[model samples]
Target chain A: MRSSLILCTATRFLLPIILMFSFFILLRGHNEPGGGFIGGLVAASAFALYAISHGVTYAQQLLKVNPINLIASGLIIALSSGLFAVFNGSNFMQGYWSEFKFPVIGKIGTPLIFDIGVYFLVLGIALLIIFSLAEEEEEIQ
Target chain B: MNLIVLPVILPLLFAVIMLFAWKYISLQRILNLVGSLILLIVSVLLFTTVLSDGVQSLHLGNWKAPFGIVFAADILSSVMVLISSIIAFTTALYSFSTIDNERESFGYYPLLNTLIMGINGAFLTGDVFNLYVWFEVMLISSFVLLVLGGTRNQLEGGIKYFTLNLISSAFFLAAVGLLYGLTGTLNMADLSEKIKLAGDNGLITVISIFFLISFGIKSAVFPLYFWLPSSYHTPPSPVSAIFAGLLTKVGVYSLIRMFTLVFTVNSEFLTNIILIVAVFTMVTGVFGAASQNEIRKILSFHIISQIGYMIMGLGLYSVLGIAGAVFYLIHHIIVKTNLFFIGGLIQKLQGTYELKKLGGLYKVYPIIGLLFLIPALSLAGIPPLSGFWAKFLIVKAGLELQEILVVVISLFVSLLTLFSMTKIWNEVFWKPAPKDNPEISFKHFTLSKKIMIFSPIVFLAILTVIIGFSVEEVFQIANQSANELLNPINYINKVLGRF
Candidate 1:
């Protein structure tokens, strides 16, 4: 309950960056250890940590948006990413590839987009649950 | 292609829309309505698709073999999802004015949507570990919803509900770990295939027991019925109704699916153990309901008793039996929710759930009184009501198996159920009016509350009527659903790489 603003704001900015990092974990999860589920969970942990330090209201305000829309957008993004795979004649959630050898960025695929969708979903649902429960915790007092 | 994934995705998308629009009641209403509409259409389409295609599987990320996550949907899963979405949509409509301002935090709208996600996910997931995860998603949301208003009673009940379920989750995880260790695959389809290859081994039996312990607690079957009565009575009627309608059914659905497809039913050892549990559960639950003084408490106890009937059918392991369980489950969700919603309305009118404190509401709210009878009689297995057909099929299953005792128990329980329902009628509606009291200022039927509460009853009552007359059709669908569950290869072939 004793979370600081610097920690909070730092996380407010830092969590997304960290979540973005987890996206790589999901993208390469098929070949290695990480994948969508775990990556999504990490993103959830980011929102949760921020919510704990900031009040639930602040967390919602921090998103500067309603949590539901955030979740919806994530779902659409995830679903459409899957749809993209389907369009490419792959199965739902099938990873698609479009790689270019840039100077720095190496091979990347459509799975990265799916991970972003998952990132928002995990964060949104997790936030939805926490905020809903936290609202009750406040009421009890 | 996996029909199961659609249920999870669609409402999830809508839940977001509802959450954003939560502050604007009209917009929230529209989002909830439109979202449910889309889900309903999708469910119907999926149901038709499954009927024609047998099963549809989608491997996530198109990765082949057991490495990638998979989703499978067969007839049973699709139909169940359809029913769940329909109930959810109707309940959302029913909640419009009834959700009380204090309880109507915008977040709740999303929570409802997520709750659907959990249920749909649980129903459609093709793997064991994933099912466990889906169960958690569904359940934790129920816990929050159960105690949403944070009334003192709700808190006490919610804590117990949460703790017991958390323990159940641990048991489920333990089961999953053991099964995964033995079978090396969490996908239900793959597990079904492998479990057959394993062929009635000792490890499988142990794992089955672990699953029984876990799902048993969740389904609120015998020995685990303690938590239901204690916790269920606390929440507002709508919350209680939804909990009654959806949550426990997930447990029952899982039990039937796993036992029939994966664990192998009636292994003599398994069936006999379940049969014994069924009898005791039936007796205890009926008696428990008979003795309860509170309306929701009685219904809660009745839920236990009703689950006994469902399990008895499953234990019989006959086609008719499993089909009966499916019908009973579908019937129970709608009927029980209707009854609870009515109970909530009664509380609104009389300001109490206590049977002793109430009387003569028939004069005050005749339509509601009539409304209560429809589901009550249906619940009690009266002839010409949907409840009768549920029991009839189960009894037919018992007769086919020549299990006379189970048949007799089912009959006696039906009578007792009727008696308990009548007691509520006698006390709450038929008896002479109590002296005008402070709690119920004698003013009844606000336009908004009437619509909010009556809609659930109207819809369910219509379903009761439809299902009653359409017994043959309902039974056919239920039978096919049961058949699909018993052989989940069709499901697995669709979700994972085709075998």
Candidate 2:
């Protein structure tokens, strides 16, 4: 879908802010309502909007890495987070937290890591399917 | 971290690793082989642990029983896992020769491992909702595996398979919702106690029917089995083989577990209905096989028929009956998968699955003919084979129950099963090759490929013969498992940690 010049410019301006907000959602997911699934979906919508205003090829170039790779890596991260508990002599998926606080993201834990993994997974899979469909449409045209 | 959860965890971890290693085909194959071997070892250990220590339960995320998701391994669950791992290992070996580089590179290993994980989870899960989740996991992976080749026939079959399964899943979910509403619990052990307390209600009977229909569609019994024959013959041979071996059996297992464990109020009406369905499923399956000339399609119909025997055992609702069902289940999975592997081999040699277009295997490949005979005769309930023992127990149970008519129909179905098996034999092996392509042989294939093809079939065939010869020991275990199913007190107590 080719948008008007104003709409395209507006999408470009809104993309960064939307992406940042999605990250915020992912970070606050453990204590708040917003989580990895919703955050990833929101992030994916920003890229989808960019693809609509510009072209799929431009969006592809922006992605830098294949979506399949992102998905695989995301799953690996999530699975490893679960395994980390086993290494610590606990059950699978047992969560552990640290008191150390980062500058922006406060106390870190395995659950948060798992949420981040889910964030990448949902974003990668959604973009992968959508971009492929868009590319197919372009080919038909 | 518990031993009981390893069967589910190991395969899942392998699948994730396989996803990343998808680019390197040979490496993926090696990893799959090693991973399946590990799964086999783990499941065998689980079997031994359950044998010695009774039921093993793990509450995931460290939560207590009724509220938390529980993974429990009883004798029945462990036995199923053991058989599943064996099939997974053998199929992984067979896939090396049969699966092409194209399919292998497309994350076939990952999907296969994921499917195994799902099967293991389904067997071990103590929570009904968790069982549904595992079924979805199994279903999605199986869907991809079914349509992996992207052939037109496969896509058509995949759609049919997916649609029917989705409807069944909907039924299952609704039943779960209703059951939860009634009893306020999803744990199988807890539900067992609560359902008895809430008992004798018509609504419970309705819920039982809902579960029957849901699991019935899954197991492909009688009238609800059209999607099975239509779709099962469409996937690649190894894919179909695994589907033949394990998928419907999972449905049967769930049926057995739910009926025997949770819905313990057995009315005469329900028993009669189940008996009728069992007999019809047998007759229709065999008759359907009799009409088909294509090898896999014929075998596919037979899968439905054999499911009847298992259900008959359940309907009998006796110690011998459940044991018979358990034995039939173990024997059938190995035999059915071996038959599909042989079919794939025949297809490789003759370039067709249609019996009329293929022949002369007895003369050119006598060894292959013998291998085929083992599973074929065994499937037909010939004496001293595994099927004979399975059929004998069920028939004996029927007679003991005084259901002579059902027994008569079952015996007739056995005869028809023999007829179909003989038809495949006479056409595919005894007859002369078609005039167009006279010489049908696997002579040109490399030695490793030949070994890869033959090893799984031989190993499984040997297992069948071993089970046949060691019937006493095997039956003892089956009897014990049956006793456990008949009396769920031990299973419930262990899962709830009441002991």
Candidate 3:
């Protein structure tokens, strides 16, 4: 559980940058290769790095929300995305698009929302497993 | 709008909500109860709709068949869904009394709903790959449910259950990959027609056997049934009841569905293999049950034995045989689940599940004895009960098919089942209490707790009696479902709109 000062200092700068990049990946996932699953992994790895630099306790405090809630919310979002189509008299999981398109990300749709849900879920699951393992490691040490 | 999706989605929705409300034990309980009740109503609605309108299929995202995932509810699918919902509702009610507060607060309701959702999805989906997805959903939730308490016994059982099921899933996935590679379609209806056109018997048979092995493990047939008795007795009573009732049946349902719809080319060969497997499954299961002294363990073996009867009907490959299978399936789900629930109640009241350690229930609580007798006799295929009609149908079908050997074995198995049930009755209910033991009284339980537990058992026993008495009505439905299964054209036409 030893932490180097340089690593801790470096993590302070790296954390937000990595999170922003993960969001970027998720936002562009509809058209690009980077989607929620990969983005969530990236986000989770950034937190894992932070936990290594700081400690599991500090990293959990930084998370603010419980990982299980994040997972639950993500599932709700994903389910509702499909449900949107059903409410619109379309088939389940059918994507509906708006005419106004953003420059970086394409037109807003259910698929992107669905991807975001995946992002949260993957992030939550990854973090939960990592944190639990790290805590176990600490206990053993 | 396709109501077919409701039975699947409603549980998912309920699971998600319960997940969010995980901390509120009372709220979670009420929500689960309400959710399962609503699911029962929705399944009934779906059943009636299918009955009046014929087979129903919903293409997700409005994609055409052979391309998009479809949820189809034929008579068979609706019947299975309806029965599963009934089990879901009863289990939810049963849990109120048996499940501890720790398990409740630890996400039991959500997991249970997810399992139901998976079961419904498996029954309703028209796509093979989607069926795999549903199976995973069901398995994942079930894995957690099996090991939820994290007890030594549970973990031990969970590891074996997990390993074997993972292997089964791998086989299932491999089969799907090969089938898709061969036929270029994942839609089951599409696969039916395309497989016929593929016209290569040798490879198709190979793929079919791969599927048979995969599903055989899940359904707990013959040699593959070792995991069932080892793991099922480890879980809590309600969990074991649901597992005994619905989980293996999903595999049996898949076996019946695939063998009937998609694997007709090698009927003679497959029939021989299936009949052999069926006979062995029956004999071995009953023998295993007879040797068990524990209540749940005995019931677990009985579940395996009864599965053989269903498979036998399928091997018969006639309308009556299939009808018999369907009837046996519906009857078994009710009887097996009730038996487990009664087992749980016995454990609760007497504080032991070991036959050698328990006795005198009939002397103290004749009501309990009566309640247990209904399902016990039903499970033993006693006359004028639901199981008798079920056994009669299958035995008659076998006779008509001139499958005298299977019929004889099946009847012998029935006798063995009776012997075991009577053994339970004699040991647990009839015999006097041991010298060191005192008589346990139901007066100790609160009225509400007693009501919560007994109501489901009473309700299911009544259902068994109703189905037993109204055999004509139930058989007609089973026959109709059997006819639909026999002719895949109706399913294909409904799903693919080939007309």
lDDT scores for all predictions? 0.80, 0.91, 0.93
lDDT of 2 by residue, B447-487 (tens): 99999999999999999999989999889889999999988
Quote each prediction's TM-score. Answer: 0.87, 0.96, 0.98
**Best candidate according to TM-score:** 3
Q: Which parts of model 3 have CA positions greater than 4 angstroms off? A: none
Candidate 3: CAPRI quality band = medium
Give a tens-digit lDDT track for model 3, residues A1-141: 678999999999999999999999998787778999999999999999999998999999999988888898989999889999888888888888889978867699989889989999999999999999999999999
Q: What is the lDDT of residue B426 in candidate 1?
A: 96
Error of 2 at B27 (Å): 2.0
Q: Please state the Cα-based DockQ of model 3 relative to the true two-chain complex.
A: 0.71
The total number of steric clashes, by the backbone 3 Å criterion, in model 1 comes to 8
What is the CA-based DockQ of model 2? 0.56
- Look at candidate 1 and give me any clashing residue pairs: A29-A34, A68-B16, A93-B61, A94-B61, A94-B62, A95-B61, B57-B494, B57-B495
TM (chain A) per model: 0.70, 0.93, 0.97
lDDT of 1 by residue, B1-499 (tens): 6445778877777776665566776777668778887888888898888887677777766665466666777766777787887788778877775677667763666778789999988888777888998998898788888889888998999888888888899989988998888878887767777877876588888888888878988988999878788899997777788888888888988998898878873267888778778888888999999999999999999999999999998899888888899999888888998898888878877788999888888876787788899999999998788999999999999999999988998899889999999999999988877676435433565777567667767988898889888888888889998877666666666655665
Best by DockQ: 3
Select the stronger candidate by lDDT from 1 and 3.
3
